[model samples]
Target: MISWLMLAQAAALGIAGLVVAIAGLARRPFGDLALFAAIGAFATLVVQIVASIIAPIAGAGPTGDLLEYWTYLLSAILIPPAAVLWALVDKKGQWSTLIVGVGILACAVMVYRMHQIWFVQIA
Candidate 1:
């Protein structure tokens, strides 16, 4: 993975997590901003997946286990949409906001791990 791209994605995920978490704490319902942030977080994962594929062809592949990295990539890609769906299904209370918050946090952690795997051999 590219270093800058990884950092940007991690930061975006963290920001999204913080936003949703704050909304949950404030007892705010899911809204456009939250939805956009969730989409943005998910889109970041999609970009990461594309980068993962293109990087090797561009001679920038990670030094870690490709299978493991791809597994994490795929899983990370699923999180946002799944959380959004769950939130939509459970329209009552702050559960939706909470789920999005937790999902973004999980994405942040997963992205950090992906970065680690990418740079493991170099370090």
Candidate 2:
């Protein structure tokens, strides 16, 4: 995994998470802005997934347990959409929005963990 790309992905998700969180705090419903932010975060993870596959082929593979790295990556990829879907389904006003915000934040943390598994931990 590339250091710059990992950092970029984490930062993007962090920003998205923050945006949604602020919206939720303001008592806003799960609206376009929150949806867009979540989708943007999801898109970043999708890019990371592509990078994960191509980076290894380009000889920039993880230094740690490949399985662990992939597990984190795959799980991180699922979070945003699931949160969005849940938010849409629950429809409990700001709480649902807040849940999405929290879920996105969790994804950001997972991305950081993935970076650690790829670059910090040793096999």
Candidate 3:
């Protein structure tokens, strides 16, 4: 994974997490802003997926276990949409929104871990 791309993904997810967290705390339903934020973060993961494929071909491959890195990347990609779907289905108000926020934050952390697996850990 590219360093800048990883950082960007983390930042985007972090921002989305913060947004939903604030809305959830304020007792707001899952609104357009939160939805858009989640979508935006998901878009970043899509970009990361493409980058992961291209970066390896360009000789910037992971120094660690490629399988581990890809697994993390793929799993991280699934989180946002799942959270959004949960929020939509639950309709339990703030808790549902908070769930989405927490999910996005978790994704950010996973992205950081992916960075470690790709660039820091070396077997």
Candidate 4:
């Protein structure tokens, strides 16, 4: 994986988490702005996924636990869309905010795991 790209995505996930959590606290539904931000974060994840795939083919797999890395990768890739779908299903409801907030939290954790996996061998 590209360390810089992973870092960027992790930062994006943190920001998105803050945005969604604040919206939830404000008792507001997840709005277009939050959705767009989530999409941006997802895009970053997608790029990271591609990089991870390429890295292994280029003989650059991380020396850390492969299963753990893959678990985080899969979770990171799946969370956003599930949250977005939930939000869409309850567009006018406060539940959307909580759902998105949870999504953000999940992403944040996943990012941390990826970072750990990426650097564990080096450390």
Candidate 5:
């Protein structure tokens, strides 16, 4: 499951990069990219949340390490919207790139954290 999350994170990063690249090269607002990343982040997090809810309900374990996963998941879930909202503060879209760019980087770190929590048994 964590591996799947990692893959999704990687895909999100790629889509993020596509948004960044397209925005940069085309001289277009990064808002489009931010929107793409935000939507993707929300969808991916929904899958994760549903899985987290069901995994334990199906008799997996007490919490199934919810404490371990929550920080990473929550950060990933919040990043896109936060970035998008922050992007809204600026009409020129400079902030959009900042938010989405950092969001992508954050996703990479979250992927690592997920592996650390699930496989390495780290808190």
Candidate 6:
């Protein structure tokens, strides 16, 4: 069965990314939006961490570490805030735009990977 928690995290990140992009376009203050993304990612991270801790018990180790499998969770947890921080620290428009693009790309890859995980059924 597909894991609902894992899917939930992906959905939340996708939504958060959309919200962040909209916030970017609207030219609004990003503090609250950043906080929302952080909280969503943090909550998702907690689920992933818990899953990692229980993986051996869940018998996924013959496959791989749950942590290793959850690259999306890791990216979701780190990338947005990192992009915002880069936005704050960088003086160059080129670098700031590049970082934002990278962050968006990471999230896009995450969405694709998530669809792979959820869309395929191992019958």
Backbone clashes in candidate 2 total: 0
Clashing pairs in 1: none
**Clash total of candidate 5:** 0
CA RMSD per model (angstroms): 1.6, 1.2, 1.2, 2.0, 3.3, 4.8
lDDT: worst 10-residue window of model 1: 114-123
CA lDDT of each candidate?
Answer: 0.84, 0.85, 0.85, 0.80, 0.65, 0.55
Candidate 4: tens digits of C-alpha lDDT, residues 80-116: 8888898999988877877877787788778777878
- Name the runs in model 4 displaced over 4 angstroms: 121-123
Score candidate 2 by TM-score against the native: 0.93
What digit string (tens of lDDT, one per residue) describes model 6 on residues 4-121? 6556666666666666666665555445555556555556566665665575576643233334346655665577567767766763343443444446546645644644543452
Candidate 2 has which clashing residue pairs, if any?
Answer: none
For candidate 5, the lDDT comes to 0.65
Give the least accurate 10-residue stretch of model 2, judged by summed lDDT: 90-99
For each candidate in turn, the TM-score is: 0.92, 0.93, 0.93, 0.87, 0.72, 0.60
For candidate 6, the per-residue lDDT at 98 reads: 43
Write one digit per residue (lDDT tens) for candidate 3, span 18-82: 88887888888877866787788788889889999998899988888999988988998899899
Residue 106 error, candidate 3, Å: 0.9
**Model 2 lDDT at residue 100:** 84
Model 3, which residues run further than 4 Å from truth?
none
Error of 1 at 82 (Å): 0.5
lDDT of 1 by residue, 33-117 (tens): 6678789888889888888888899987788888888898899889889988888888686678878888888899899889988
Superposed model 5: Cα runs more than 4 Å off: 14-27, 59-65
Per-residue lDDT of 111 in model 2? 89
Candidate 1 Cα RMSD after full superposition onto the native fold (Å): 1.6
Which residues of candidate 2, in runs, are more than 4 Å off? none
